[model samples]
Target chain A: MQREHEPNEHAHHGPDKPTYNLVFVALTVLMLLSVGTAYIELPDILHYGILLTLMSVKVGLVVAYYMHLKYDNPLFTWVFILPVLMGLAVVLSLQGLAGY
Target chain B: MNAAHTSVHGAEHGHGHSISNEQHNHMLKFGWWLYIASEVMIFSSLIAVFMLAKRLYPAEEEHLVLPLVAFNTFLLLTSSWMVVRGLVSIQRGDQVGLQRALMITVILGSIFLGIQIYEYNEFTHHGVTLTSSMYGSAFYIMTGFHGFHVFIGVLWALWAFFKALNGHYTAENNIGIELFGLYWHFVDVVWVVLFTLIYVM
Candidate 1:
């Protein structure tokens, strides 16, 4: 069997072609869902909640597959996600303090 | 070890036999991740400011045009997919496919920027300048910085396209394209958050 050339010690085997197409389609569907959600009339809390939930799912897909974080080293994932968590905390705290 | 000694060792060990390229690429990715982590903080601060401003002054909500921004969001999402396709093509040793995908990605990025410019013009015409109000200032600062990021990503994609045309990449060695994809996708993810927090919510 022929071994694939490893770009780095931490890099996994690259994703297959079909996986990219699948992710592309998934992202498109999520985009449409989020846009559709925006047009629906719901209570303020529920409306924002659904929008944010959909946004989070989209972000997860992009970061995991498109960015190859799922295939790369866990260290890199920590490097990327920690800051995002911190940002979320800070944003939420500020929003609370601002009386929103 | 000294530079001369290291070079001699590298030459003796040869390319694939040595771990130099692998280690170098790992370090490169690590550094890029660190840079992006810092960017996360910067954008977080901008988002915080925007939220606070909005809370303090509710009138800013009336100024946003959701439908136009939603269309812009779709363009960025499509461009992100194109960049991923470019990466996938190069991974499969399809240089022509990579080049075409990258060219399309750059065009899409440019169109997104053009729409943003038009949006800003509309805002300013409606007295939504930086000095207009706290809301206006926050709005421009957050989205403008994001626009600047998209512009930079487009330039990066253009460079990648030129490199692909010059046959600088191959199936086994295309770290440049991968790194560019990471950056472009990061910009896209940022926009997803911004669009949700600012436009939709």
Candidate 2:
């Protein structure tokens, strides 16, 4: 298999054209959904759970599409994702300590 | 255009070949990752402190001032949209459009900072100070730090806007723009977390 070029990284071609506009629209819709969800009077656990889930989805979409993590290689994944995982670990620990 | 150097550190080398180039980018990438890690630690600490303060001052929870922050959130969200639109403009090689979008982003950012300052004055008038109470301390520190980031982002966007006017970036060589996009998106992400934690919660 031919190696991916690095100099003009953005000018890359794939089996199908990247649908950035579509991805952006979807992101906007997700944001709106989160906002609407925030206004709902759900139980506290379910409320926070839904918000966190939506946020996780939003972050995934932004990373994969806006940041092009989806198109990149595994090396790129490790480079960026390790810190995020560590951050999540820290957040979880903090939440645990806070008794939340 | 410069010749594509065959060195391991040039720009095209990837894994399994020249360990030098691979290692070089990896070092920068690792450093950036560490920077983000350190940032996570710092913010987490601040958030921990905020939580402690909130627990100690549950009475202030009823007095939680959120409308201004909600408006501030709108400003930030609008600015994020503008910055993303500017990136799309750059990708399309629309210099005029890029300049316009970046200008809107900068203006919105400035407006955000302005409202934040105004809110600070309002807080002071209402006897809220850095040492006033736990609520005041946490509220100011967390929101103040975020406002500072917005200020820096505004400056960064302004610089990029001027560069675009000077024909500095092309669709083919717009890594600077993308880097700015990363910073902008990061700021937006931070605000998203803050809005949920500090305001909505």
Candidate 3:
């Protein structure tokens, strides 16, 4: 078998074309779902929940697959996720304090 | 020593390679992620402020042209996928494939930026300037920052493309391309949040 010439990170190839295609499909679906929620007349909580959940998932998919975080060392994932989570926590706390 | 460094070490444990190429690349990758983390902090702060502004002013979403922005979002998402494909191509040692993929990514990112410029023009024409209203200001700040990031990513993509054209990245030393992929995907992820908060909500 022909070996890879100069594979980066010690020749550990990340996700392939098929995985990328799958991720693309998933992102589009979640996006459409979010857009659908926007048009439909739903309860505030329900609409917010759907949109937030789908947005998070879509972001997760991009970070995990497209960013190749899932394939890399776990540190990069935490490094990327921690700040956003910390900010979310702060925002939620502030919202709670404000009686939101 | 560390799991993250294991790949670097495992490849060249005692060959002084640790002091050389592979380890250096891994460190560069990690440092780039740290930079991205800092970027996340900056964006999160802006997002918190936007949330507060949004609560006060409440965005007038009726004026938002969802179709165009939605297509733009799709364009970014697809462009991210293309970046991944480009990385995969180099991993398979196909330099031409990588160049083609980067060219695609550059095209998609450029189009996204163009649409953003057009959208800004439309919003301004419709009386939504940065200083017009609190929500308008916040909207511009958030989306403007993202647009700036996209512009940088586009320039970065062009640079990476030329590098690919010059045969800089190979299957073994393609960390530069990987780093580009990470930055591009981070831009995409940020858009996912902004699109929901600014437009859909």
Candidate 4:
């Protein structure tokens, strides 16, 4: 009964198990790429720019898929993302205030 | 002909029921996500403080060991994958698989903490203690708190593993495991930022 129940549930709501494996592979590859990027001798600003971009992508993938935010209700996304947006504002404001 | 149409309609009904169940699961996940968002606020404050201290004492970067930190990053990332695999296993009704994956995750988390202890010891040898300067304080507070979270996550995963041993979770009902994955993944995400800021930058 449980096995029968899962296919229907997954078909209705979520990705298959194979997709999770694919996502895992993608995450690992991205992690390696980020670490590799760190060693490259680009100018400081551009180097950080690439690293931050990669980091954001990794975060997005984990939150959206691994955390099921992508398939979940939009309200959950808003609930989680709003505070993060607020946090970003605080960081930026503090950076400005600190004369950075 | 009528029987064929009735069977088709029943199939649609089954799909509808499945969707409702899926939505119920999402509602539970929403509550967990809200808790995670609160966690985000806590970490954000610590991160802001760390940034301020870094600005004040820019030369503290010399005390950080980037290669070891990167290796630790790999450990956490691997553990995150294991937890996700654990969730996938339980979702498929594979109790043994779930337990195995979660056990690996716990082990990886422990090793990550061990490496952290080693790093802290190294830092102490290099004259970087919590009271050494504002930079030292911020570094310890941020990374130490993250390490604490990893500690809690390892314990949480162990509990989940035991629960799996008792067959407490099923494909239709595994909110406990799912919530654990969410928390673990959040911890990993926090480390991603902390690693970049504290070590790389």
- What C-alpha lDDT values do all the predictions have? 0.83, 0.67, 0.84, 0.81
lDDT of 2 by residue, A1-100 (tens): 2433433334432211135545555656655665676567889898778777767776676556555557544565576667667666766676577775
Give residue B65's lDDT in candidate 1 (0 to 100).
Answer: 82
Each prediction's number of clashing residue pairs: 0, 0, 4, 0
Give the chain A TM-score for each candidate.
0.81, 0.75, 0.80, 0.83
What shift in Å separates residue B123 of candidate 1 from its native position after superposition?
1.5
User: Which candidate achieves the best DockQ against the true structure?
Assistant: 3
**What lDDT tens digits, residue by residue, belong to model 4 across residues B78-185?**
887787777767777788989999899999999999999999999989888899988899899889999999999999999988989999988777888888988999
Candidate 2 chain B weakest lDDT stretch, 10 residues: B1-10
Tell me each candidate's TM-score. Answer: 0.88, 0.75, 0.89, 0.86
lDDT, model 3: 0.84
Write down the lDDT that model 2 would get. 0.67
Interface RMSD of each: 3.3, 4.2, 2.4, 2.1
List clashing residue pairs in candidate 3.
A6-B171, A6-B172, A7-B171, A7-B172
Tens digits of per-residue lDDT for model 3, B89-201:
88878899899989998899999999999998998888888998877887899899999999999999999999899999988778888888888999999999999988888
Pitting candidate 1 against candidate 3, the one with the higher lDDT is: 3
- Encode model 2's per-residue lDDT on B1-201: one tens digit a residue: 112423444355455334543344335544554555566556666776776677677665554456666667667666666666666666667688778978988998999899889878877877777898987898889888888888998999999999999999776556577667656766776776777676666
Model 3 per-residue lDDT tens digits across residues A1-100:
1232343535654666777898899999999998888789999999999999999999888887787687677888898889888878876776666564
Please tell me which model should have the higher DockQ, number 1 or number 2: 1
Cα displacement (Å) at residue B157, model 3: 0.6
Looking at model 3, residue A2 earns an lDDT score of 26
CA-RMSD of model 3: 4.5
Q: Report the poorest 10 consecutive residues by lDDT, candidate 4 chain A.
A: A1-10
